[model samples]
Every structure is written in structure tokens, then in C-alpha cells.
Target: MLVTRQKTLRRFWYPVMPVGKVEAGPQPFTLLGEKIVVWKAADGDVVALADRCPHRSAALSLGWVDGNAIVCPYHGWSYDGSGTCVRVPQRPESNGLKGRVVPSFPCTVRYGHVWVALGEPLAPIPDWPEEDDASYRRIDQFYETWRCAGLRLMENSFDNAHIHFVHRDTFGDIDNPDPPQPAIERLPYGFVARSDVPVYNNELQKKNLRDDSAVTIRHITARWYMPFLRRLHIRYPSGLDHIIVTAATPIADDRCQVVQFCFRSDSEADAPARDIIAFDRRVTEEDRAVLESTDFDVPLDMNSGVERHMPSDQPGLLMRRMLIELLAAHGESEHTRHDAGRATQEQKSSS
Candidate 1:
């Protein structure tokens, strides 16, 4: 189904770009197939508006940012942060600006990424206590497009069974194919899962910790914030803590922008940021190759029987169930389901 059109998917905040990237000029981003342009106001507040110029249908992202408004390069049309067309070069100041406003979305900065909400979000951005602790050395890791839907990445990260195979070259322990079920607690928006898994101490681990042990148990505490944010706090036996914050921002039905940052208990001298980022890139790419091969849209209907499920799929199941219930809460499940089928059919027919 096309989750992009579902109310459950749109009523949440998604990362648009890194804080440092938007200051230069208008940046383009897509969430659930809607185009938006983000730019830093003169006052240093980051904001977003519809990417279209509204006059001649030029992409506003192709324009430049003025003091507090974005000026369209096509014809010098300018709009303020509230999306009001405040300036028109060829016409009288206020005459051509009448009713020339575009829609504006809620935008803010959190966890070092700029976020925009397409609707009135039900919850605040997920909190990161470690961010304020000051003891952890945080490193902004990666921001790039991965060739898979955001849901595919989210589901894979929560599904622990794949690591032993998908990441065998990294930290996976092939000796244990079927991992033990994790303890999961459902939260208001998403869920928290805890698990202990034996992992081979690969190149990344050897650098982080000098221990020669072939395998180490990972004490992982993972939190999923509704729609697409995931945080994992991993504690190694050597007392080193690694926290990973990842957000899979949907760029379209078949692709997503993956943003990640890591906080380590060790100093840069102990483990270089470059090495950690390189290792993480490899692990995520392994996931990308496989996910891109599958259907981008995941069926929320457990009874659909399109995909088989194993007991180890609890994390994904719970996630799917929660989203389905959220759809019903908004009373759009039935109607959205009908539309989803029609959309899928239309897409197939066209292809």
C-alpha cells in the first residue's frame, strides 16, 4: 500500500536537512512525495515552505534566500517565512502580492537535524538525554539517499534476525542464526526494545576496544519514535557506550534519506570519527542492497498473506499493528485502504 498518502504517516515530523546545510541557501527536500524548500532566515531560524514558485511553477529551491524571504529566480518573486508573497519586482509592491501566499509547515531544529511537520504533530521530537550530558563525544555521521522506502529501513533495523546474515562481515555471529526474542514494551507513539546478542568482534570493535575476545555480547536498548526515528544505546562489556541515532526520512514511495549520528564514550584519540563513520557506512549499505530489491511498500494488513512472518519478526509486526491502529484512530483506515489499492493498481497499470 502507498503509506505516503496515509494520515498516520503525514501527521509527524521528518528530518529535512542538517542544521549546517540550510544556511547557505534554499535546500530542497521531499517527505511523503511533497516538495518543500528549507532555508535559514536572517534571524537564524530555519523554516520551510512549498517548493513551487506559485506564479510560473518554478522550483523555489532554485532561488536564493533574501533577508527573511525566498526570492524566485525566475521572475524575482519573493515570499516571507509565513509564505506571504512580500515582494514582486515588476509590479507595485502590494498590488501583485495579493493572495499570492504558499502553505508553510512547522519547522524546527533538533538532534542536529532540521525537521518539518506536514501536520500538527501529536508528540515532541524524541528526546536525547545523552546530548546534554556533555560526556559523550558526538559525531555527525551520514546523510545520503538510500534506494529503499523509509519503512523498509525502519523495519530492517528493528528486525534483528537479519544482522547475523546481512552483516556477517561486520559484527554478526553466524553461529546463532535465529536470535532470541527481545523484550518489547509498547509506548504511546512507538515502542522500546531490549536485547542481548552475541556478535563477532569485527574491525570496528577491535578499534573501539582492544580486547582479543572473538565475540562480545551487545546490550542494546532501542527506542522507536513514531513514523521514522530510531535510537540505539549499546553497552559493551569493556564499559564503552555507543549510542546511534538514525532517522529514515521518506523522500518518496521508493526512496529515503538516511541521516545518522553517533555518540561515543571514548575520545577521538581512542577511536577516530572517520573510522567509525566508514564502518557504519558499510553496514548500512549492506542493508540498502537487500532492501532495494524488495517492494517499497509494506502491507500493514497482517491478514493480507502477501508476506510470510516468522516469530523473530515481532518488532516489525508490532510496528505495523501500531500504525494500523493509528489509522483507525484517525478514522481513515477503510477509506485509505481503498485508495491504496487503487493507487497501486494504477501504478501497475501504467507501468
Candidate 2:
């Protein structure tokens, strides 16, 4: 099972860390299994570069930050934000080492997270429009890591069928376990799924609802952007709106970091942030537990018959198909090719 590098996936922007976390020092991070370094320049712009130093192959993250340059700890070589080697202590007056450079990545700060692009990005950083709306109260951000592959996390987030069974204890009602089939619309970038179903609320959430009616219908809309960005919009009958925007960054082939920002139309002062965070934490932990125990590290081919799916799995199926198409388009579908070869070999052996 050889995992091929996803070159096309690298063209999208991925969140590295929270904006507040990146201080004046050199912070090391791994995106798409590539080691990279991030730090603020003198003008307060975020700079991302290959972690390896051009000299002696040292990690630039292991060095310190000068005025606007990163100094190599092994030697006294310093590189500026533009990836140019600006200063060399051993050869200060030598212009030969001035033009030496390291790989620099495009970086931007958005939605309280620092995003980096490993290659030429197809578009700007994806964000939910309501995040900046005056009516929506932005809740505190949360971070979690899953041992599963990044694609699995995205599929899980896009899936509405699993909430009934996997989240029965937190937000799901076991009695009404069936989720209605959603209306899915394909977008230029990704797709959107909308469902009008009975919304189940936990004890904490129930207390916060303005209407304590016996029946409550909610409109749930989920949108997915190219690569690995998702936003969920839940609208209540009482005019309350809740949005969950998540970014799953691939730390490794088998690991990913999920950063979520929640927004609501209700007043934050009425619904304390602590209580909201606690409720979210419980729901997410439940999801994390199930996602980590899955047998496959990545999603299976849509037509491979590796797993069974129902009508409720329409969104997930679409997502998997989209991923396969992207991988094939980029010529990175080695696993798919490998599976076909194995099947052919098995048929020959059987004959």
C-alpha cells in the first residue's frame, strides 16, 4: 500500500495554526507532510519557508528570528522573508552568498487562522460569509487532532447520516434515527447538501432555545469547498442561526488537525461561551472516537465495493467521487491503479 503524493491537493490553502499562536519566534509546522517554518517579519507579516536551511540542511525552525530574518542555529546564516540569504557571519562582505535562497510558501492570515499555500493556489482562502456578519456572534475557536487521514475527516463532516447512530448520546435521538435524503447541488468549487429535518437538541442546547415547543423543525445546509474546507448552516424556527466552519489540515498521511469556529445569531452574553464550548467539545469528542476507530485510513473508491452505503450516504458518495476525480486528474491515483492491478492478478491466479 504505497501512498502517492497528492500534488494537486497542495495547490489549495490549508490552515497551519491559529493566528495568535504564531508569535515572534520561529514556529515549525508540517503541511502535506512537508516540514515548514512560520514567523512574523519586522513589518508583522507572516512568512512561511521550507524548514530546511539552505546551508548544512539544518532546520530553520531550530534557529532564532532576528529583526526580519531567520538565523541558522548551526552557523550564522540568516534568511529574510523573501527566502534570500541576507547575512552570512563567516563571509559578511561576500556577495556570493547573498543571493542564495530557500523555498518560500505563500501565507495569509484569515478567520483567526494562518493559512499557507504550498503551490500556486487556485483561489483565495475559503471562508464562510456569515463569519464577518454583524448579526452573527463569533464564538471561541477550537482545535482537535484525529489519527485518521484528512480526507476521512472531511467526509465525516459532510456526512449527515452518521449523526443519528454515532452521536446518539450527544445530539442525536435514537428514537428518530432515520435522516431524510438531502437535496444536493454541485457547485463550481464543491457541493452543497440541504435537508429539512427534525432537529434534536442536548440538554444544554434545549435550555438555550427560546422555544420549548414539542416539535421543532430545522433547516440544515452543508457546503464543502474544494480540497478540505466545510461549513454547516443550521437554522431554527425561532430565527436562531448557527454556523460551523471547519478546516482540516493534513499533518501527515494518517493524521490531521481540525480547527473549528462556531458562529451564532444569538447574543454571546446570553449564551456563555464556556457552556457552548463544553457542549461542542462533547459532540466533537464523540465524533473523534468513532472516526479514529474506522478500519480504512482513507476513503474507499466509490465503485470498488469495499464498503456498503445507503441512500443517506449520497453526500459522502459524492465527496468520495469528487476526490477520486481530482486525484485522477492530477495523475496521483496510484492506489486506484494498484487496486486494479491486484484484481487482475487475482483473476489470473484463479484461472
Candidate 3:
């Protein structure tokens, strides 16, 4: 029998939602694999707490905001920005509520996103170079949960060899293709991968390479963040400049939620944007089918019995191992003990 994993919510910062979505009042989301409620105080500070209301287990999200406090709808219990129960309508003249505090987390709204720190929140959120520009457009998109781990799913984006088989006719042609040799760089926070593979564009490759002509190189730069987030920057100068892809994948053990932010340059055609959207959705669906059908509940550690590597998979392999070590050292092991369904149900009822 498979044993449930230990609960270690602290270790990394979690991307909850876009800053604008969390209104002046109480807003709730899932972070660090836990359901949480956030509110913008009158002082302009963002407060986050476990969504559970200590009183009768009602969701704090259902509670209305009065000044900087969140007033629970059930029996009227009020919690301050710090998640402390300040007032109990049913029992006013009592000092018993002095130490009644909910689980509160450190949070910040930066670069159009609301991030919650599961640990001490020692560092700033990862910076995207284009986030500050007024001309940059941000589009938030999401995909259904994947059975495989988030890190594994993200590595698929960095793997050029998979394109030949996984995306085949649509985004690549692997049937009669030349081998792919990728150039990789290790950055302080993440990694950058690029390849001059002619299969980067299916249409153009067929036109130029069909006659043994030279094809252009496609520079695919993927900036990865701590835990499991990848900000992809793909530039084909003759193709498009401002094409970017950002994803936040929070793993609930083996299952993962892949949230994507697709940003386009102020100068690209509308067709590429549309194609990117369709291509991502289609390929992700294909991946979901493959992962779900396989034995996805295998161990997350490197020793788990799975058919393994080649030169092309080196970058992905190193990244996965590093992530595993990072999580272990931080005390958040790769195991799923948290019930995501319960968390979602609680949020919906409370919100």
C-alpha cells in the first residue's frame, strides 16, 4: 500500500493569482497546496491566511470585509489582517479570544501577480524582463491538471527531441528529420536552452529544407524559477520578437496545475498568437492522455523505475535532479498528502 506523504507547506513561494483579481475585500486562492484567502487592507498591504474560519469551519472567503478585518458570515466571527480573531459576536465580553489566530502567510503583489510565501519569503519574486514595459501584453491561460509531476511536464517544453514525436505533423516533422543538438546555459535561477533545429517551424522547414536549403536557427530561452515555474522566451527574429510563455505549476504530489502566461511582442502578427494558443492546448491535451494512462503514481525521486536518458535529455535530467535535491533540503519532500479536492470545494463554498 502507498503511504501518504508528510505535510510540509513551507519551502517555496507559490503564485496564487494576478494582483488585480484580488479585490479590496477578501480574495481566496490555492497556494503552497493549501486553500488561502487574501485581502487588501486599507493600508495597502496584502494579507493572506488559510481560508478556513476557525469558527464552525466556515470559509473565511465567504466573510465580508469590514475595514482591515474579515468578518465571518457564520456566527459573525471577525479576523484581523494578521488572521487573529478580533471579535466573536456570540461572546463579546471575553478575553478567551486573545490567542485565536489562523494560519497567516506572507504575501506580495508584484509584476501583475499575487505571490504567497509558504516559508519566510526571504527573496523577491522572479523578475520577467518584459513585465515593466507598458507595451507588453499579458494573457493568463490555464490547462487541466496533469497526472505527471509539474517538473516533468515543464521539461517537455525544453525538450526539442519530443517535438518530433509528440507534436509531429502540427509543430514538427520527426518522421524523416535530422538529429537535434541543443545548446544549453545554466543561469543563476534557472536554465536557457536553444537549438538551430530546422523543425522549429513546420511550414518554413518544409519550404526551405525540402530542397536541401539552409534553415534558420530558433532560439528558445526558458527561464526557470525555484520550485516549478518556467518563463519561456522564444525568438525567431524573422518570425516574432516578443513571444513569451510563463507557467506556474504547483504539484499536489504527482498531480500538477499548469498555469500559463502567454505574452506577445508589441510587433508580432495576430496569427502567431492564435497558433501558439491552439498548439499549446492541443499538445497539452495529448500529454494529459499519455500521462493519465500510464502509472503516474510512481515515486517522484530519481530512482523511480522509468525508462531514461540520452544527450538530448541531459538538460532536463539535471534540472529535475536539482529540483528534487532542493525540495528535500528545504524539508518539502515529493509526496502528496494534501487533498486538493477538499480545498477547491472549500474555496467555492466560501468565495
Candidate with maximal TM-score: 1
Residue 287 error, candidate 3, Å: 3.7
**Model 3: number of clashes?**
0
Clashing pairs in 3: none
lDDT of 2 at 184: 93
State the local distance difference test value for candidate 2: 0.78
Alpha carbon lDDT at 247, candidate 2: 77
Q: Please, what are the lDDT tens digits per residue for candidate 1 over residues 136-233?
A: 88899989998776777888888889999999888886778989788999999999999988888776668767677888888998888887889988
- Candidate 1, 203: how far from true, in Å? 3.2
Output the number of the lDDT-best candidate.
Answer: 1
Report, for all candidates in order, the number of backbone clashes: 0, 0, 0
Better of 1 and 3 by lDDT: 1
> RMSD of each candidate?
2.7, 4.0, 7.2
Give one digit per residue, the lDDT tens place, for model 2 in 1-351. Answer: 112266777788888888777785888998888999998877888999999987799999989988888888999789888898988898878732555489999999987778998999976776467767988877756876778666676778767678777878766766776778889999866899898877577678775665666446778898888767888888888888878888778886667788888888888666777777887788888888987887534544765666787877787778778777776877776354456578899999999
Q: Model 3: what TM-score? A: 0.77
lDDT of each: 0.85, 0.78, 0.62
1 against 2, candidate with superior lDDT: 1
* Residue 27 accuracy (lDDT) in model 3: 78
